[model samples]
Target: MVPGPVSNDRLGASNGRSSPKPRILVPEKVSPDGLALLASDFDVDSRPGGLSPQELIDLIPSYHGLIVRSETKVTAAVLAAGTSLRVVARAGVGVDNIDVEAATAQGIIVVNSPAGNIVAAAEHTVALLLATARNIGRADRTFKDGKWERGKLVGVEVGRKTLGIIGLGKVGMKVARMAVGLGMKVLAVDPYASADVARQASVELVPGLADLLPVVDFLTIHTPLLASTLDLLGEAEFQRMKKTARVLNVARGGVYNEAALLKALDEGWIAGAGLDVFTKEPPEEGSVAAQLARHEKVVSTPHLGASTVEAQENVSLDVCSQVLLILRGGLPTAAVNAPLILPEEYRKLQPFVKLIEKMGGLYTQHYVGARGGMVGGRKFELVYQGELAGINNTRPLFAALVKGLVSSISDSGGRDVNIVNAALIAREKGIVINEVHTRENSGSTYASLVTLRSYDTDPAAAGKEERGAEQIIEGYVSGKTVYISKLDRFTASFTPEGTLLILHNYDEPGKIGGVGMVLGRRGVNIEWMQVASLEKGDQGDKGLELSKVDSAVAGMEAHGSNTKGRGNEALMILGVGGVVGKEVLQDLTGEEGILDVSLIRL
Candidate 1:
């Protein structure tokens, strides 16, 4: 019998005691190779033409999985209608058409093949660059119109020319390699990538656009479109480039300002431009993009960067594998949101995952300070203790930790860090990671504990007096809630959520109230507060009064103190609401007896 849409009722009744086979619906055309692979184990229904939004909503509730290409929009209405949908698989990268937030909120996994089009995009970038530089498009049009004006087709050679790349990601790195093979000097600017990574790619790493624009003969952008990158090349940036420089953008639309680019082209700020993507696809007739496409100095394509047969096949197969794995009760490597942890393990370890992520975020934010640049050559160590150490799959937790750590340092264009690319990005930034699992509790009060530590490779680089100072944070799961148990030597407990203010101050009575006053003045509400004194030991209030005396501070001097030999130190962890500005932080730090204050949002 020809497979038709299977309803949830039919599926549930198929096996009285056993689970039914997952039914997958493919509304858009995919490679036969991918379809055949899914057909082997699933009830596959393949339809080449996509369905309308209403049609999709009507048919979606029957199936367990839905796969599509760019043509189909996974709207929130459709997601809400998919009563049985476990996954929404996109055949290619850039899930602009998918409402990923809605899918994630509905507990439906969204997977995309990010690596499938890297080479295709890179080749297209180089192709467009060479075409623009050599006036290939104009020459072809003139020749087809029966004209032989060789003099008017004078062009520049790419050999030995400097190419500045905006982002050194997968596609950008491939472009760099291809440019180098053509004997071009490559310079790149990526905030997340280290100098070591740039050297490995044989490219010079510039700190930002200002440093990269003036020196290069060609500029290419490969960054995703977001608030930070939208209209990245504006009038000011275009003016910074050499008048003869060329521009290429094959990564995303809206990254280059259409108005600014047209102005640059018309004003002769740049010689030419090659574009494979635009702010609006199929730009309106008589629009700026349409006019630019017809310009003699511009060569444009209809978003054909991933049009190769190999790229389509690769993405189709890649997303198909992920869908099958997720349906079969396995974790997908390229999941765009949180991991699909096993039900039992997820119930037990979900809070722990959140706790560790917050801890990692808190440590990185505190270590890097407000300037927000990565410390060079650092190492991240994760230690899992007690019953948490024996979990069969710890990859998800590691990815969560790395995600939090990297997200704190880099601008990810609003994209989430996931298991597939977290470790890869960490390696790109020259971070060495080590993981340890032990059955012992490690002298912790809780049953399970996770500790994260970050340190610099060079001892002197970490600090002057405190050489090799490591930022350590430990947490544990208790029942349904997660608490940060210890930070450095101070012991306290607070739920790892929302915004937090950690203060190191003199062990005096008025310090806590002083902090409260500053936050209150700033209109920030304190939800919870925990204070631990290093000099007071773990004896609670009695130890506090005892350590208040000056000579008694000497007895507890073994515990580390920020102000050594002067007095005992107190640590306050405050859960706060609303924004805590630098001015408020400065006020808190300026308060008497307040030594240091660090704020983090998780």
Candidate 2:
């Protein structure tokens, strides 16, 4: 059937057609309610099933817009088929499978229903948790198998269990509230969330994982799988968890280490695990996920958390609304990956990105050493992923995140900066700036992750290869201290305020005990400690090379204000029986094994 043509001006200014209603194609099944609304004003077609990628490639060129669910793979090839397409709408949050870059480059707006299924997803996580804890699915299977042995299917109750939620945003907070309603004690671990917010949700909020591990009975993970969060729950972390504790992971796979988890479950280090995601998809029979599914103690599901009928309808409605808005030239509101500052602000921020890239260059020049030549010339590559993808001024936002990160490293002691001058200055110093953007909604904030990479030299200097070297630096803006997230090779470490301890030790047994003993004697407390070996992952680089520790130690030094009196103060205190003096603090902060001290004030 030939769809009706659009009006003259509505055909798009470039096409120069007369008054026309935009033609839309729902290539996949959408909410009937949403379709009813779209049909009122749009030339709507709902052919949503059994279409091959080739069929979609053949059909999309005729429509002005396309809407779809997970059944479609909107790859670059598929996008190329949409010659007249003005918008692509995803009826759900994640756009990972879509070729967003291709659409954006074609000036086609992409829209998603980010808010519609949030509560649904959150509730699903809770359901999965309860099911996992109480052996609900196992019990159902047993009953279906002609078994009436209820006594053998004993399970735990949600009531009175301490639930640890990793991310305290919408999904995490909703789960927290629901868990509270079920009489579970909810504890949240989110650095971004204020304590008052958790309290308002009737949950206790802890600042870090160290504080959360020993207390919870059931641990439910909701944090996104970012560089910092990948393998977040690993062998070391699982080892710290209480032996009686059970784990539930309904968020993204890879956020937890599947191998480590297998070890944990197999060794009985943990009571059991409930997983809806795995590092691998559609795992083979007898795979760890499959084995877990067969295990009486463990519970597993096929990623059904976001598959409810209500969730489907809500997401369709939400996506349809956003599609209409985008077709009318409006930006998306539920964009999950990047936050778009106003155009005026974006224009104001572009130059700063160049400035920041240059500052990254500066850090590379000094700490990155000879191999740091990758950032020496040409433009630095900055990837802007997330909410930034939905905006018309996405490039500018990319520039802003980069510039914001870079300006943070300079000793300029100034605030206002312009892109015009930033580029000029960067160019004068032979700096190049390039960027790429992508996005998704991971039940966290519509966030932006900007990864800065050097332009030339060896490619290995980009991610994990560049670890030990200090990739980021701290600079004073006003009087407050700010944290800059940097990647030293594969590891991401942050410097938070407190105290600094510097320790140098050989790779030997009892080093940790020795360090602890020294600190204990001087009355200095150790809140948390982490040790990284540069050669641990690179077995080829061990013993002879000290690795990134020297650079990491130096980077920590750059963040602290220089202390004045050390030895002299210690002597003075010792002269008067020496309570609370250098011996104690030095023993606490600067003992032989103490690499650094970061005192926690609160």
Using TM-score as the measure, the top candidate is 1
lDDT of 1 by residue, 298-399 (tens): 999999999999999999999999888877866666666645234445666677767777776776666555324454356778999999899878866876
* Predictions: Cα RMSD each: 8.4, 17.0
Model 1: runs farther than 4 Å from truth? 1-21, 194-197, 285-295, 338-340, 359-372, 375-377, 383-393, 406-430, 436-451, 458-602
Model 2 local distance difference test score: 0.56
Candidate 2, after superposition: displacement of residue 108 in Å? 1.9
Query: What overall lDDT goes with each candidate model?
Result: 0.76, 0.56
TM-score result, candidate 1: 0.72
lDDT of 1 at 129: 93
